[model samples]
Target: METHTELVEGEIDLKYSLAERVKTLTPSSTLAITAKAKELKASGIDVIGLGAGEPDYNTPENILKAAAESMEAGFTKYTPAGGLPELKNAIIAKLERDQKLTYKPSEIMVGVGAKHVLYTLFQVILNPSDEVIIPIPYWVSYPEQVKLAGGTPVFIEGTKEQEYKVTAEQIRSAITEKTRALIINSPSNPTGMIYSEEELKQIADVCKEADIWVISDEIYEKLVYNNAKHVSIAQLSDDAKERTLIINGVSKSHSMTGWRIGYIAGDETIVKAMTDLASHSTSNPVTTSQYAAIEAYNGPQDAVEEMRRAFESRLKEIYPKVAAIPGFNVLRPQGAFYLLPEVREAAEKTGYTSVDDFAQALLEEANVAVIPGSGFGSPDTIRLSYATSLDLIEKAVKRIDEFVKTKWQD
Candidate 1:
């Protein structure tokens, strides 16, 4: 076994640059915060964790059974580069059945996850200094992926007043000749803000006029609250569909994060290019995952609906209690399990000028771990998740309220 000391000693003059792209990477803030919380909890500290991106629900039972069946049926070999034809056909059916759009298998490319699909597209599409317009309070991975692909990220800050969604005008203003694409994650990760059909129509109009590509991350499409419908950019019009990359997965909806299955539906040319890249790269997502995902897409959706109802109930339970707190400004998240709250007001009055410090102080003092907004390109905020039990959410809100008030006074 290679010990750490021996590994460090033997790799001294290795052709590895201390100054490569990997060296320039910032670690995932969500993962870091989650780890710190776990460490503190292991030491017997009471910690409230509101930083996870996935739902609290377990993976649906039928999918697990499907995985077992796949293994039993000898589905252990690597599939086609894009995916199995059966899975691709299922994806094709899903787009038509769910989103009211049609596509062939050639227009559908599956990857390990939606993140991988987007990053692969970023590397393939973005030239040096090509710009991608990302909305503020965005996913933590967006800027990093853009930089990884050697592109510039231009962020347009959205607001609570505007329902935490970027407008077409903002998109129009942000675009330059260097702008290659825009990544829009509806039912967004940090904010849980869903773009309405009308809102998407307006944005689609702008993108069509600008002739730029849209990387629509629709992973949380099925988790909407109340009557808020998810609008796919691909469903807008022929022109809008021409340049849109529709990214979806079974992760959030089916509580299948570990399954590592996602698909991209878009222009056949781009899909083919991504498929070729993924074929040579990952070859295919896990054979079992692909099989189970087919069952997820084609299986009974009652479980998904049940989970959605639970999330909606929890959202109602948490919203008022969270709003009752003095310094925190929380908008009603439209979908997903997150809350990007403005905590800087109280932090500022208390001399904690940054959200990072506020998060650290809360973690150290109140023993609650959260992600600061600066990671998502907004400095005066923090992101919380209401994905846990109603009891936990209530307890967490009360504890947070008390902590914020007492700490601010000090």
Candidate 2:
């Protein structure tokens, strides 16, 4: 047996060490850059942040009132681990009304947020060494969550010319016997691109033929612009619905990022497994937040439309200005409040070797914070969220434009 002193020293060493599963995980680059921007602002610096992937608007008044009413009625105790029955019914109704898809309460599992819902999903469905197909330039959490679940993430690149959306052929080529699931995030983060219905149907056929699960992340379903429509892969056919897990929340749609409400709609067996796991883990989603989400689903949708229009207007104003910058190639985004601009040539012209170095220089020199695309599996581009005011967007883009011109030309 080890001596007491030796055991105490071992414990001390282990205190600073993390689990093997999380040791290789990368921190979220978007959150990191946003934190740095906030830190700089706290120090009295003029930092223009375009990094956070959240709406600047507050949660709608009706939702807030619902939460307050629920609390006043003393409905604050823990509900079912999956979620409250009322909220599940609301989710089912919302899906049926919006997507023409029907789901029972047993087919839905609600968690802390969409992130938590996805994490729980991977935990229940993934076995060790199983592979999950993910597209490049994906959300920062997808790969990390797969790794945390003891699964490998296989990535296929989606080139800029394709609007950063991958094709079914690429997915077909990447599949193998070990493949367990494929993630499809329409209105994708870091890219703001949506896959069309035809494209989704093609992808769904491949998934069905290969016996793989389709994880459809539609968190930004309500944010499409330019008359673009958002279609769920689950809506393709009954077989597609049977094989797809629809993950969505009110965070982006209702401007309720802090409300901690998201749910997964999928097969009853898988949802039951996730609920059982949550029973031992989170116990339940926040009680008050669940009520707020119910109101968000059933209340007037004018606030949602208002926020969508505001984002669309901002996109129109900023897209041209950013695209006009020298050596920058920007794709006009069809959905979501983000702009991913390829800045490789601009970085080179400004004497930087890579976009990562260029991003750091711009933040330090111009006090403008944007996420380097290296973390999103694209090192040649950068992501800017236009969730702020139009004035801020203009000022930040102008500063970026001036920074490039002054360094390269003058």
Tell me, by TM-score, which candidate is best: 2
Clashes of 1: 0
Per-residue lDDT of 178-224 in model 1, one digit per residue for the tens? 98998889989888898888888999999988889999999999989
Write one digit per residue (lDDT tens) for candidate 2, span 129-216.
9999999889989999999999999999999988899999999999999999999999899899999999999999999899999999
Q: What's model 1's lDDT at 91?
A: 87
Off by over 4 Å in 1: 1-14
Q: What local lDDT does model 2 show for residue 217?
A: 96
- Estimate the TM-score of every prediction: 0.94, 0.96
Index of the highest-lDDT prediction: 2
For all predictions, the C-alpha RMSD in Å is 2.9, 2.6
Q: Where does candidate 2 stray beyond 4 Å?
A: 1-16
